[model samples]
Target chain A: MGAVLLATILAIFTTMILALWRAIAGPSVYDTIVGVNVFGTKTVLLIALITYFSGNDDLIDVALVYALINFLAVIAVLKLIRQRDLAAAPEGGDD
Target chain B: MTELILDVVSGLLLLGGAAFAVIGGIGVMRFPDIFTRLHAGGITDTLAPLLIVGGLVLQSGFTLLTFKLLLILLFLLFTTPAASHATARAALVAGLQPVTRDSTDQKETRSSNS
Candidate 1:
């Protein structure tokens, strides 16, 4: 079981490296952002897997927090890119 | 016997999830444009976590830990699509055009003519 978990973690690491490559070499800003987003999601899974591997239940909370932060970070970045100002209203919306 | 069965099930789920994540990563890296990449990333954003965390939930059995695992999975399920949509919309609004078949065909014809 431990071996299986370890292998899963390693496989996720491979994916994270691939995503990092895209983040670095992606042709456009959104590509880079999406790559980073993928990387962060993998990180959350990795953390969760490690919790079971190491018998650290506490890490589960960390994984949950990480997921929340990852989602928020993506939305915030998208809003920034779209509006150029975070506080400004979206297009055709009442400000 | 039941424990062994559970272990096998979880192992298969974990391996399958890992495989999906790698495929998604490859797609994200190899796809030609942002829209295609977003589509690829959706695999990991959606299925990989579903399988992986579901396996973890099975392993944890009926404990509080199981609920926590499910919580994480649920949060991911709801947020990933929202994030993907926002990303695609932002890309479009920022003047990034998706590459369509017609556009590609036009480009190929123009190149051949040149």
Candidate 2:
């Protein structure tokens, strides 16, 4: 059981790496946002798994709160990006 | 005996969920643009946690902890698509062009340009 749990955690870690790669190497801001969102998701899963691995269910609340915050963060970022685009729309006649 | 079976089943679910997350990450990396990438990132990443939490809930048996985990899944299911939609809309408004595959659309645009 421990080995199985460890393997799952390792897989999630690999996922975080891939998401981090995209967040750093992505061509556009939106791509980076997408990466960050994916990263948050994996983090939530990691926390959940860790709880089971350690036999502590208390952290489920933490996972739930993180999920809430993750959603807010994504919306906040989109709001900021939209504002920036609106601000620059006047100067950028074509695009 | 039943508890042991539950753990093994949950373990398998955990692995399956992790695989889904990795695939979503790869999709984010390999997809051509923001819109297409969202198609991968939004759905799978949100769904991954649900499966994982469901698995954990199974392993934990029926308890308040299970409800807590379910709440997390509910939160994710509610939010991820909203984020995806906003991100796609923001990108489009910010001047990112989407990749189109249909040749007729291409020819129409070409004719319009010429």
Candidate 3:
């Protein structure tokens, strides 16, 4: 079971690296945002798995916090990117 | 016997989830445009977390930790799509067009112009 968990962790780490690459090299602003979002999701999963692996159940709270923050961060960044100023009003209907 | 079965099942789920994450990563890397990349990212954002966290829950077996993990899982379930929608909408608003079959030739010019 430990071996399985370790392997899973390693695999997720690899995926996280891949996501980081996309985040860094992505051509468009949206691509970068998508990469960051994916990375955050993986980070939460990684944290959860590590909590089990290290036998520190308390770290589960960190994973929960990560999930909430990641969602808000993505939304906030999108709003910022679209609005240019976070305090600005919507210029049109589509935006 | 039951413990062994549980262990095996959980292991499979964990591995499967990891595999999905890796595939989604590759898709994000190799996909042509932001819209397609979002499709790949969506896979990771949803299914990978579901499988990985669900497997963890199975291993924990009715503990407080399991409840917390479930909360994270449920939070992810509710938020990922909302994030994706906002992203796509933002991209559209930013003038990034989707790549369709007919737009294959136009993609390059459009991206270059953008």
Candidate 4:
């Protein structure tokens, strides 16, 4: 079981590296945002796996908190982008 | 025997989730525009974590840990899609055009009218 869990974690880490590549190379801002979202998801999974491997159920609460924080951050960034865009638009008209 | 079976199944699920996540990253990097990338990333954002967490819960067996894992999954399902939707809507409002190989003119027209 330990071996299996380790393999799973290794695979997840590989996926996270790929996501980091996308985040760095993304042409548009939203693509980067997508990459960040993927990263956050992977982090949540990693925490769960760690909890299993370390025999530490206490880490599960930390994982839950991270998940909640990640979601809220994404929403806040989205709102900021929208407000910035609206402010940039010409008064009484759009581009 | 049952424990062994559960371990194998959980390992497989974790692997599958990792695959989905990598594919989502590829989609984000290779897709021409924001909207399609969002679709791909959103899939990973919600489903991949759920799969991996589910696997970990199984590996943890019937413990309080399992319940906590389930809570994490529930929170992800509730929040991920909402975040993606908000991001996409914000991108649209910010003038990020949806790329179509054959429909550049349509996008221009739409943007012009906005």
* Deviating ranges (above 4 Å) for candidate 1: A93-95, B102-114
lDDT rank order: 1, 3, 2, 4
- Per-residue accuracy of model 1 over B1-114 as CA lDDT, tens digit each: 999999999999999999999999999988778888999999998999989998888899899888888899999989998989888887776777777666447452111110
Candidate 4 clash pair list:
none
TM-score of chain B of each: 0.88, 0.83, 0.90, 0.82
Residue pairs that clash (backbone atoms under 3 angstroms), model 3: none
> Interface RMSD of candidate 1?
3.4
User: How many steric overlaps are in each model, in order?
Assistant: 0, 0, 0, 0
The sequence of per-residue lDDT tens digits that candidate 3 reaches over residues A1-95 is 88999998998888889889988886887888989999999999999999999998888899999999999999989888877777887666654
Cα TM-score per model: 0.91, 0.85, 0.93, 0.82
Model 3 error, position B77 (Å): 0.8
Best by DockQ: 3
The stretch of ten residues in a row with the least summed lDDT in candidate 2 chain A is A86-95
Candidate 2 lDDT by residue in tens digits, B44-78: 66667876787778876778988888887888888
Model 3: share of true interface contacts reproduced: 0.88
Q: Give, for candidate 3 chain B, the lowest lDDT window spanning 10 residues.
A: B105-114
Misplaced by over 4 Å in model 3 are A90-95, B102-110
lDDT of 1 by residue, A48-94 (tens): 99999999899999999999999999999878876788888667853
Residue B7, candidate 4: C-alpha displacement in angstroms: 1.8
Sorted by TM-score, highest first, which candidate order results? Answer: 3, 1, 2, 4
Candidate 4, residue A11: the lDDT equals: 73
